[model samples]
Target: MDFQHLSYFIEVVRHASFSKAAQILHITQPTLSKIIKNLEDELEVILFNRTTRYIQLTDDGEIFLKFAHLTLSMADDLQVSLNDGKLLKKGKLSLGLPPVIGVSFFPHIIAKFRDLYPGIHLHLIEEGGKIVEQLLRDAKIDLGVVVLPVDERHFDFIPLVERQLSLIVNSNHTLAKQEIVHLSELRNESFILFKEGFSLNDRVREACIREGFEPVISYESSQWDLISEMVGVGLGIALLPETVLGRIHTESVKVIPKTVPQISWDLAVIWSKHHYLSHPARGWIQFIREWVWLQRSMI
Candidate 1:
């Protein structure tokens, strides 16, 4: 019926509960139910198979969901197209950033961007790389920074950071004296790894499997600092990017280069090709390109 109705319907479908969706949408459950009932009456179809606890989409609901999503996306495109000329003077951009990547690289970049384009309001959404990828697919954010090798069919991306992972060990550990270590050498060592949603987690696990052993993961965390802290206390050794290692402040950990079946910590700026990119989003992408180039030139 309207964008609000479509949005409310999508949220209910997403949560699978009318009460939960109402809570998120900041409306009373009765009001939301009435709106949905009105929509169903107008459409001459029941959208949901409702139960006491949750709901499921009916066949008609499933079909309507596709059209609803498309209609909302089209509305967004129309808005962006109409405002294209005005956005350069003042605008807003939403960027989804993984917590690890944000802490490691983007603070300075954000400051620089703000200094250059003070009028543009930048909204940062922090999530794991996997969630960030999902947000891009759903067109929730304008752009996102994710681990490389994204789905090429649905998105366009620019590679930003590419470097090999380094090993972090406690200073008193046996491997601390080594300048370089192989993946196989740590077969017996306990590893502290990032949690499941992070791309780095999968990267480490795959690399370990390739070297003929699954890592003995003693601890898993969402934050890089926590993983590093676990290593500082001699809980376990960890594989992290040098970019992260340089910024982490801990005296008890030793940084060693990884050799043999090198695991790369690659990152990129990504946007959905299926959705429209706003003027501010394009400008931010160009700024990153130049910034990366300048850094490489100096190096």
Candidate 2:
């Protein structure tokens, strides 16, 4: 059936009045009525029961409404996918990323994507997980690389990598030589943590609370590098993901695995469900999934 006819039919069903539907559609009542009549004839089904004062869907109309909604939704998705392809060929894709993940993977991903689709532009925004989530919710970025267990009701998450949390301490610290340590071991030690609004900070605090004590916070910094640097120089120990450790290596600091309520964080490709996925966004999603699979195979 013609999509326009289905559109009119859906509108009529929604309003339950031809004049109301036409007014909303910015079409005249007679034209709208004609379109619905033509749609019914084509389908060979009575779609509505019209009285002098009211319009109601017939039994067939009710059934058709469900299929109509589905068909329209799919059609819209198909159109969006097609338009996205054109965008990838000529437009740009904006990616919002957390600092640690962006530092490690953004260059490689951008290089690979440019090599494959030279025409598409790649824009990057470096922010913390909370900022990334806000940008996604606001439709500011097409996609985001963020830490997961985020409120999944608003955004869809695709896992990229899962890395264990590490306990970082100055080389001269008492726990520095240990290969593994429990959260309780650091109860009295002053800590350098990520500032408020960061997911990692919340994870670290929650893990500490579960161990029967809150962390002794000497300092908090949103800059990951600064936090690591502080821990390396005997300022205080900090909890960070394995990926961050890989980025900021310091001879003055050591990394040990955490065991009690073993904490790990997921790196995810996140996007809002309310926002439509652009072509480059979809392509990047596929590429990231394949890359993750390949990395797993190698491991």
Candidate 3:
């Protein structure tokens, strides 16, 4: 029940050796062992099974680990929130962004943010939307920019932009000369697409289904550049967001407006309503919202 005991128990589990845990915790091995034993006694459960050379979690310990992690995370957040004013000039802000946004927008924004708040440390992580969502839920990131359709119950989101999706093919491909192509006309054509769980891939599949057939997928990749390169080789055509298309430098590929209903994905800034945002985090969020709005208006 005591935080110190829980901390020691977690360290022991993490290292699987009391001596190593003690070394990491800057405590004696016997002290660390006593803490774990005390934690087990307080909880009325055996937390670990020990041998001369090894330590392993008991079934109860495995379950306890999950709660322990959550408890410690909450405690850390509380401390951070309470100390926010004192830490305002020296705190760290962590952000998560999907690949397209990271490549296209983050550089200038990050540079400006750092210039304005030189004392604040900024950490940005680039990942797929699913990973960014997980990081937000776990409180690993203060803010995340992700393609929309996230679980609205857990996050507060502000729509930044709607990215138009376009059908792209090799410039020399037969379809490239057409200003527009019906979705149904590509029913038999092989498609290079984003991997499963990506918003783009889902949109592409849904569009194809609306046209009366599932697409013939020839390749799937998470990287837009690779998808563009594959499409350039005449392997298959792809449906990608306009933002991603802007990043493509491959000369072989060309965008073709879809004749069917235009498809687009909304990009949003997402944050946990339950998590406390630090001063710097709040500032950066506002800056991002405003910057995105300005860019949208210009476009």
Candidate 4:
């Protein structure tokens, strides 16, 4: 069987959409369909059960997927070994990034990475941390920037940073002058928050529950700037990462330290333990661990 065809087969199942997988593979949908049909004909087993809403693996497909991953992983490794240590001369790195990371430090980090490994093409997806984790598991993304306390048993992660959650209120709001606000103080306050899948949204909600009240959610959004804008106009208060607040000008808002259950998220770059990481992915992880953190030590 052609490993190239097997790669296509894997991408189709991984994405669960012919068009989407085709897009990622940089092939036409008709071409992708033909490739799969050829595989099915050769194997004499239907690999996928297709429907209007979903395309899922058949029994044989599930079995083949395991071998597919192993073979592709080994193929990638073989390429690296044969390259005589000239890693990243050519490769693709599909990565998932949470919006917070995408807007904050991602561009700078990737810029430096590109300067070192200019031959590598990068594909990025900005989504909630939960979705990023799922993409990594599905083999859609080679690596991911996600919020921590992730499943360590199933994946390996290098801690990037821990950002404190800060209380954002309108400058004229009653709590604005306070240096630190206890969770209980906002018992009656309405909050502007990130959408449901976001770890921040869940983290804040659970923290509020621990403090004895459900926070009144006034607005839900994916953009921190929008959430901060809502808070600035007195629509509601918000809790955002200190890293995010530093990037936007919230002139109408006051940022205060949060405690009485201090809220924070540990950021990390993660990849599935079972997935085969390419040389570029492994090298990037090392760069973050060695170079990025070393730079942090200097600061």
In candidate 2, how many clashes are counted?
0
Best by lDDT: 1
TM-score of 4: 0.71
Per-candidate TM equals 0.69, 0.68, 0.66, 0.71
Q: Which residues of candidate 3, in runs, are more than 4 Å off?
A: 1-88, 293-299
In candidate 4, list every pair of residues with a backbone clash: none
Q: For this target, which candidate reaches the highest TM-score against the unseen true structure?
A: 4
Q: Which whole-number lDDT from 0 to 100 does residue 128 have in model 4?
A: 93
Worst window of 10 by summed lDDT in candidate 3: 81-90
lDDT of 4 by residue, 1-299 (tens): 99999989988988898999999999999999999989899999989998657999999999989989999999999977658334667777888887877888778889988998888888898889888888888988889988878998878998888787889999999999999899999999999989987889989999999999999998999999888888888899999988887865857999887667899778888999988888778878887898656768898
lDDT of each: 0.88, 0.84, 0.82, 0.87
Worst 10 residues of 4 by lDDT: 79-88
- By TM-score, the better pick of 1 and 3 is 1
Colliding pairs, model 1: none
Error of 3 at 280 (Å): 2.5
Off by over 4 Å in 4: 1-86
Q: In model 2, which regions exceed 4 Å deviation?
A: 1-84
Candidate 2 C-alpha error for residue 233, in Å: 2.1
